[model samples]
Each structure stands twice: as structure tokens, then as C-alpha cells.
Target: MGIEFPKVRVNSLINAQTRNWDVDLLQALFKPEEVQLIRGISLGDVSARDKMIWPHTQSGTYTEEICDHCKSHSEDIVHALWLCPCLNEVWEADTGWSFRNTVRWDDFQKLILHVEEVGLDLDLFAMIIWLLWHRRNQIKVGNSATSLGQIVACARQQLQDYNLVQPMKPATESANLHTAVTWSPPRAPFLKINYNGAVFQDSNSAGLGAVILDSVGGVLASLAENIPLPQTVADMEAAAVRRAIMLATDLNLSSIVLKGDSEIITRAIQAEEQSLASYGNLIEEIRLHVDSFLNFRITHVKRKRNSVTHRLARHVSDLVVWMEEVPSHILPVLLTEAG
Candidate 1:
């Protein structure tokens, strides 16, 4: 007859001091067949608390010593998500979403707990980490590296699409209810510079558009330039910001208000925390340019309020600069906003 033992822990059958199975305990608690199976389990030399073991690997361990992409540092969750050199571009492209320097945790679970405690966008944060891991796996499988811009775009679009399909929360609904829908001119003595970026995927390039307007909504200067594709949408937006600053400097404008439709890039510029993301360098450059002005402020607006720059950004031109006048195509939007 087969013997059935009550629920017994493996630790109970092991002698703590000897770090070996207690034959007497095993025999008393389990049948001969069960004892034989228990004896097959190997014991470590040093006595320690029992841990969950992964059965798939030969070492029965899940983590690796070095990162598969960089092949240098240990492949821990933190290293894979935030510290890996190979992920620099990917993280940089996500400028405003990082909390690396401000937060610390031993493992991914604790990090997530910390993120939740701080009221950070956990969904976006998790999405980026997941995408990063997916990217790492793609590289491991010998797939070509995806562009930074594409990856960033994918992460943001996925998040946006997900949020769109979800039921609107009361707080979100309230915020959207109060959002400004029409363009407004900046207050006295501050010329508003509205900049935007547009990706020309078919051409494998991007466009930068900036339109500087006075307090009365009259266009001061506008520019549209084509450039080689950037690694991420944030990169392109950062470039657009730099171009806008350059235009302001060229005009010798000191007090200015910079506006854009990208909340991420705008917030990144305004954030007191130093960015370590790939777009960090570009953002720093923008800051340096910003310091040259006596009164400079960066703000974000909805896409609807930034139609002129959006139209200009979609321009498929090499380089076009208008001083004190905008293109004919933008006249309707400008007139509508002014009226």
C-alpha cells in the first residue's frame, strides 16, 4: 500500500546545522518512494534559508552575470532597465519618464512599489521597461536594432491607445474638461515661439517648424527645415526646440515664451532634475541657449492650439524662413486664431 504524508516542508526534512537531509525525519514523515525522491535533491555546503529555485536553467538560477546587449555589467532588473549602456539611447528618448537618480531599490518589485508610492505614471513606466526588455530580446535573436524614435513612438502610442480605450477617470475627465482649446497670445513684452516636429517616415527624415508671434498674434518669424531622421520623437522635438531658440537668438529677442505641443519635451525642459536620458545632451544645449534670454519660459499647449506650427512642421521643404510673414497656407489658421 502507498503511504500518504501530510503536507510537509522540505526545510523540515533538512538538518540546518549539517546542511543535509535528515534521514530519520524523512523516513518518519514520508513513504519509501517519497524519501527516495527527497534524497535525490542536492544540498548546498553552507546552511541557508530555502529559496525558490528556477527549474529551467542548468544552474537553477534565473539571472545572468552580464548584460546580453552590452556584455559588461551584471544582468539584474535595474541594470537591464536603467543602467545598461546599450539602453542609453532608449532611455534618453524617454527623457521626462526617468527617476533613476532620485529613486533606489534592490529589486524590480521594490522599485515598482516605490513608483506606486510616489504617484508616478506606473503604466508608462512599466510599458517602457517592457519595451526595453523586448528590444533586448530582439537583439539577442539577431534582429537589427530598432531606431530610438520608433521605439519611443511605439511606447507612447501604445500607452495612448490603451488609455484611449479605457474608461475615463473622474480626475482625467475634469482635467480634460478644463483644457484650453483655442490659441492665445502671450502677455505683454513676451513674444511666443511655437515649435513643432513632424516625422516624414516615408522619406526617412523629419521636419522642424517654429513660428514666433507677437502679443497681438502677428507673426514675427517662422522657419521650416528638413533634417535627417532622429533616434526618437523626443530627439526630433528637442531639435525643434533648439531651432526655435536659435531663431530667437538670431533675432536678438531676450524676453520670450516658448510653446510646444509635446508635454514630455516641454516638461523635460522645465524639470529641475538633470536628465540622464539620451536626449539629455540636447536638452542641456537648449538650457544653455535658454540662459541667454532675460526672460524665458517653456510651456506646453494642446495640438489644436498649435495648428500653425503643426502645419509648418508638415512642410516638405528643404529650408524656408519667413521674417514677419507666414506662408499663405498658414494664413487661414492664423486668421482664425486671431479672430
Candidate 2:
């Protein structure tokens, strides 16, 4: 099976990623959709200057001249991501994977597409680039410099921590399950919703939330929403999941499962401790909807495992309301744990 990401689809992905309309941030980033756009844009889409991010680290600063900072502009995208001294620490740490010593953007692009293969969160790869730039600016602006030692420490922890990817290594989601004699994999095949909360200046805050779908056998209500300024995104995601659950209840569904990447929300919902008291109102509402479930389950997945759902959340935000009855043949795949 020759899988390919076609041109039209690729542009759509780039447009999705560059939603902010800020060209600079778009420079260092590449998406599965973008791999197709390289040649098209090269022919004639954006100007040659708009393409600075890619060319900045790719061999020559302007395709033929070396940059002043690093004498040899030989540092293309791959070198910048996996090699450059500026980001080496964050790359290995914030992320738990090592770059295989790459030299070109194509190689780096390959990594983005096959991140699931490498057991990494492909969505946050852009965040990695963004952070590297931030770390670089910190040293440049005399904010606070970083060291390789710190980077490695962070990477190992994150690697050991983020278990959203399949083939989950041993990590405890709760203390209650520690003594279980036999470990049967997760049985519930259902949809998962993930949300991120950002507390802005003063009390004004908004969240970026997404709802994703993974069905077992029955119909799944997979969706996402962008809520107005919220107290936080984590809360927003939790609230979103809660809203989805309540909707599921209203639809008269007997069984369903809820998931989010927010540990604070998941832990609070699970223990009913009200951990971060600020989300009291949202959490309380969540509690009410949660009680409506006859056979309901809620849990958390690392940001990595939440990707497909995350992508769908972003795409489906404009369109909510769905009730898709999955094909019978695929029910087994949905019910059983992902291989």
C-alpha cells in the first residue's frame, strides 16, 4: 500500500497549522500536509522571502550565503532540530527521542510524518520548534540560558511520562489499580475529548479544546468546540468532555467513556477531590453530568495519544452534532484494545 499525502490535502494541513497567520512561527514548522506544499510553493505560492524559516538553517542563509551566527550554514532543518547546540537540550528532553543526526529538512519532515512509528507525539513537534526558538531567544535576550544537562533530564522524564502512544509502557493512572492480580487491557472502545486551558492576564482566560472519536461498536458522538474566554484550557477541555457526556446522556445513551489529556481535570474527576479549586463551578457541573452515566468511564491520555482526536477536534469545531454508526466489521477493532 503506497500511502501518500496529496497536494490539495497538504495545503489544507498547512492552512490549519498556520491559523495564527504569523509567518515566522510557520517557518520552522512542517505538517504531513506541508510535505506536499514544498514543491508547489517553490514553483509560485508565497514569496521567496516568506520561506526564510526553512532556508535559514538549510545549508545557506539565502540559498548560497552562510549565516553570521554559525559560520557554516551547513546546518539545515535536520541539523537544527537534531544537531544545533542551541536546541540540543530541549529536543532530547522536552521530547524523549533522539534525532538520528540528520542534515536536511526532508529527513526532519520524514520524522514528522512517522512520529507514531518513532513513538512520539507528532502534534507537539511544532511546539518543540517553537520552544527551541524561545530557548534561543532567552540566551540572546539575556533572560536565562539553558544547559544540555537540563535538557536531557527533561527528555527522559517526559519520555517516561507521556504514555498516550500505543503499546503503553507501565505507568499508573491511579493508585487503586496497583494491586490488581491480572491486567486485562482497557475494554471500553469509545470517544475521547482533550482540552488545554490558558489563564491569561488578570481573570480573563480562554481555552483551546478538541473532541476526538474512537468507537467500540455503537454510535459515537465525536466532536470539538472553542469556548469563549474560560478560566483555563484544562478546565475547558474537561468542561468540553463534561458537555459531551451530558449530551450523550440527553441522547439516552446507556454506555459511554470520556477521556482528556488534562491530568488535573482527570485526577480531580476520578478522586472527586476538587484539586484545583478554581475550576469548582465547571467541575461541579461535570460531576452532575458524570452521575448520569449508567456505565460510564473517564480517564486521561498523554498529549501524544490524544493526537488524532486533537486533529479532529480542531477540524470539527465549526461543526458540532454528529451520530455516526460505525461499520460492524470495524467493531472488533474498536472494542478490543488498540494493538
Candidate 3:
């Protein structure tokens, strides 16, 4: 109504079989809180061929069985989520929300804009919309319909969980004047690899070791390798890091955060300038390999914090790899860090 969109246009929108708009336009059109949800609907991948997906179904395709919200009525996203008689109680129960007076029932974008105009929390509104859609699918699968109060409770829990898992902070942590630096785990779904290189000056060789752990402190991988022809300690550090990246890429990890004790290597990796160190070429090589991951991070920690990797490297005067497990020698250090 606000933009003169007709019911025919509404039908075209609901039945639209293509994702034509870019994320920027969708974000501008919807409430700030709704942008992610809307982007999720659009799938955010330009190269992926656009296809119609019924938002209310688990299988992602349309099915008559998913029309449980209103089997007798002409069901669209607007009607199923906003106008269904089954969902009337959900709206009535959330007494604090002024959705009825603020939203224009004819179109979805108008509803989001109106919610923002009324100074409503779009996050909660988005959550309710998500929950309503979620509950509809749940009912379609033969689960009992969730009550309005249950829906509200679930939304709050989901919001809390989302906040806890956000990895938005800057990668560099400010060093304290006195406190010792320690290793920290990466966010969920990202594997953290603490790696170090040990130079055996007497033998003119170096050994590289890496210990990989998940967010929950579970071991995923470990590598110990001897560089028979070693350069400087910095070169060894660079080689170790590059080896870690190569392994992560081989495993097809989508996200990784690599920690190391070499300040020179870490600084070189983070900096845009080419390293002047003897192993600067190795650092550049590591950076190039990092592009293979959807997300990658390299951070520096104190040597004491990297004790486990130091011990592992000491053992690899020979080359070896342990997949899905670490050797018995690394157990004490791993246990302390896991705690």
C-alpha cells in the first residue's frame, strides 16, 4: 500500500522462482535485523544458480504437505506467517509488540519498514518471524504445535546463542604491561593450530610441529616434520606455518586460526609489506595458500603459551603425522591447555 504494490504483485513475489536481487539492495529494503534472514533466503552466492525454495519447508522444495498453516486458504508467506488463524495466538501473546498497528498486511518489506518506523526491536521481530516459520515446519512434520509462550522462550534462547558465537572482535589482542600472554581457542567451527619450529643448531637442521584442536579442545590433527636443510629459525617458523596452512587446505577446512610463538613470522604474515627476513619468501607463500580457506587467521602468542607445540617439535627430529589424535608424549601439555 505504501508503494502501490498490488495483490497480483504479491502473488508474483510469493511464487517468484528466482533470486534476482543483490544483498545490498535487499539489506536496504529490509530492517537492519532482518537483513541476515533476508540474505539467507537469497543464499548470498552469485555464482550459484538461483532456484525457488519454499521458506516454510524443511526439504527446501515446495510440497502440499507443508501447507498445514492453512490447507483451505490460498497460503503465501505473508498469510502463513502473519495472517494464519493458528498464529493469531502468538501475536496476541507477545503483548509488548505493536505489530498489528505498525505493519501493512499487504507486503513483507512494508511490514519490516513499519516495524523500524515504530522504533521496534527488529531483532526480536525477526526472531518471531523465524520462529513462526520454524513452528509451521515443525507442525508439518507431525510435532505438536509450539505455544506462543514457547515460541517467545525459544526465540530468546536463540538470540542468546547467536550472540555467544559471534566472532566480530579484532584479531590482535592488546598486550598487557605485566600479565603473560596465553593461547586462546578460536570461535566454533574453526580449528586452532598451535605450531612452532625448533632449530637444532648442532645438526644444522630444524623440526616443525603443529597441534590442531577444535573449539571444544578436541584434538583433530598433529604434524611433526624435520626440515633437513634448515635456514634461519625465522625460516623454520615460516615453513611450519606454511605446512599448517597446506594441511588445513588438504582437509578442506572452511575456517582456521593458526597460532605461533614466532613474533617475526606472525608480524610478517599480518603485514601487507613483503618480509625482509631470509624466509620472507616462505611467509609470502603461506599468505598465498591462505586464500584457499573461507576464513583464515594467524596470531602470535608467547613461547610459554606455545609449550605443547614446542614439545611436539622437539620430538620430530623425524617427520610424522597423527590424524584425529595426538601422541602420548603431548598429553600433559594438551590436558593443561584444554582445561
Clash number by candidate, in order: 5, 9, 0
Clashes of 2: 9
Lowest lDDT sum, 10 consecutive residues, model 2, at 42-51
- Per-residue error at 173 for model 2, in Å? 26
lDDT of 3 at 78: 64
- The best candidate by TM-score is 1
- By TM-score, the candidates rank as 1, 3, 2
When 2 and 3 are scored with lDDT, the better candidate is: 3
TM-score of each: 0.49, 0.39, 0.46
lDDT of 3 by residue, 146-173 (tens): 7766877788789889988987644343
lDDT of 2 by residue, 1-339 (tens): 122434323334334443223233333355634432341221111212222132232111234433222456563555545555545545645435554434232445335544654577754665455445555567556777555456445444555556445463456743333333211233554344333332222222222333334443233444444443332344445555555655566677655566656666676677744333434444556676667666767776655444434444433233355456323333343333232
Error in Å for residue 110 of model 1: 31
Model 2: lDDT of residue 18? 30
lDDT of 1 by residue, 44-87 (tens): 33343333444322222355566776788877767877776676
